[model samples]
Target: APFRMSFAASAKHVRVLENAGLVRRKVHGRSHVIRLNPAPLAAADKWLRYYERFWRERLDTLEALIRAEDKAATRKRSRK
Candidate 1:
């Protein structure tokens, strides 16, 4: 917010954010006031957490399988 950018680029970025439902812009005379809308961002966070848990469980299972296979290979070599 402290930094400066071109008006055209700033408007384009604002438009993209508006389209994504992350912000709401209201025009007061010649000035545009932008407000943050948290609902969409919260929903996206929830979606990401759900998939994070899913991948964690999947990777745990894969790790267990790999460990078991390594132990089996070690035993086979020790018996030779």
Candidate 2:
């Protein structure tokens, strides 16, 4: 095998993906062709993007707060 896994292990992984609706397998005689089902992945991508933006906004706010605190500390140091 080009990969580290044996054929049986690879088949098990493919079966899991098929059960999850993440892949479709077509069998022709001795050959099996596996194709990815992109719908689930696309939905996951959309979900992740929303959270990415949410966290980005939250992090930006946190950065602004930290910077304000730092500036206040500097001003206090200058006055002392």
User: Cα RMSD to native, each candidate?
Assistant: 1.8, 1.1
Clashes of each: 0, 0
Q: Write the per-residue lDDT of candidate 2 for residues 3-79, one digit (tens) a residue.
A: 99999999999999999999999999999999999999999999999999999999999999999999999999999
Per-residue error for 69 in candidate 2, Å, reads 0.7
What shift in Å separates residue 7 of candidate 1 from its native position after superposition? 1.1
Per-residue lDDT of 3 in model 1: 56
| Candidate with best lDDT | 2
How far residue 26's Cα lies from its native spot in candidate 1, in Å, is 1.2
Per-candidate TM-scores read 0.91, 0.91
Supply the TM-score for candidate 1.
0.91
Q: lDDT (0-100) at residue 7 of candidate 1?
A: 82
